[model samples]
Target: DTAVSQTPKYLVTQMGNDKSIKCEQNLGHDTMYWYKQDSKKFLKIMFSYNNKELIINETVPNRFSPKSPDKAHLNLHINSLELGDSAVYFCASSLRHTGELFFGEGSRLTVL
Candidate 1:
């Protein structure tokens, strides 16, 4: 069984369109996070949700929202997608706020 799973593994959308990526983890972790990796391969955390509390990175735009429906689920919603938003979004989970993270395969979004 997959530890974590995300849908629409490959997304091809035009600029300005809105899209959502859903993620679920069965690792029984208390913290879930969303990390974005740009084409340059630089990975940065976008958001972290733990016990219903959300921490958003200052660099992340308002258009990107991370939702934690439950302890085992974390979803990302992006509005007005732009060319700069094209990248691999990864869903990850950790046993605790400072625990090792387990990441999903990642969802690649391409904006045309």
Candidate 2:
């Protein structure tokens, strides 16, 4: 079974549009996180949830929100998407705060 998965490997849209990316993990992990990889390829943690509880929010804009209904899924929703939001979003899962993570291939968002 796939450890983690994200939908729409590529997304292209114009500015001001809203978009959401779904993420799921079947590894029975308790923590899931959303990370953004910018044009420079620098990975930054956006949010993390453990057992459906928000554990971390790394100063991300209000335009970006993450929702986790359970231990195995975490989804990201972006409102009023802008060109600056163009980047690769990766969904990952780990057993706890400091553990090896399993990442999805990535969902590329292109806002023009």
Candidate 3:
């Protein structure tokens, strides 16, 4: 069984469209994170939620939002998507504030 899973593994949409990627973790971890891998394959942390609380918010745009309805779920919503948003978005979870992270396969978003 996958420890972390995300929906819509492949998404292709036009620019300015709004999209959401749902993520869930069965590891019972308290901390979840959203990372963006750009076209260059450089990974950057977008957001982090610990026990359903926002703990880390990186220098991401306001158009990107991370919603955690519970400790085991973290969803990412992007508004007015741009070409720059075309990349792989990964959902990850950790036991606590740190340590090994179990990551989903990644949701590849393509904004044309």
Candidate 4:
């Protein structure tokens, strides 16, 4: 069984388009998060949710949103996607806030 899974592994779109990525984890963890990796391969956490409640949000632009329907799933939505949003988005889960994270395969987005 996959510990973490994300759908729409690849996405290509023009600027101003909106898109969403879905994630699901079977690790039985209480914490899940979304991270964005820039063109330079720098990863930054965008949101963290614990037991369906958001706990951390890194000053991400309003265009980026993270939604957790339950402990095992977290979905990300990007509105008016911009060129700067072109990068790999990763979904991760941890047993706790400071525990080791289990990452999904990642969803790569490209904006033209």
The TM-scores, one per candidate, come to 0.94, 0.97, 0.97, 0.96
C-alpha positional error of residue 18 in candidate 4 after TM-score superposition, expressed in Å: 0.9
lDDT of 3 by residue, 88-108 (tens): 999999988467999999999
Candidate 2: segments with Cα more than 4 A from true spot: none
Give model 4's TM-score versus the native structure: 0.96
lDDT minimum window of 10 residues, candidate 3: 95-104
lDDT of each: 0.89, 0.95, 0.95, 0.93
Candidate 2: tens digits of C-alpha lDDT, residues 48-93: 9999999999999999989998888899999999999999999999
TM-score (C-alpha, index-matched) for candidate 2:
0.97
Q: List where candidate 4 sits over 4 angstroms from the true fold.
A: none
Each prediction's RMSD over C-alphas, in Å, is 1.2, 0.8, 0.9, 0.9
* Candidate 2: residue 31 lDDT (0-100): 93
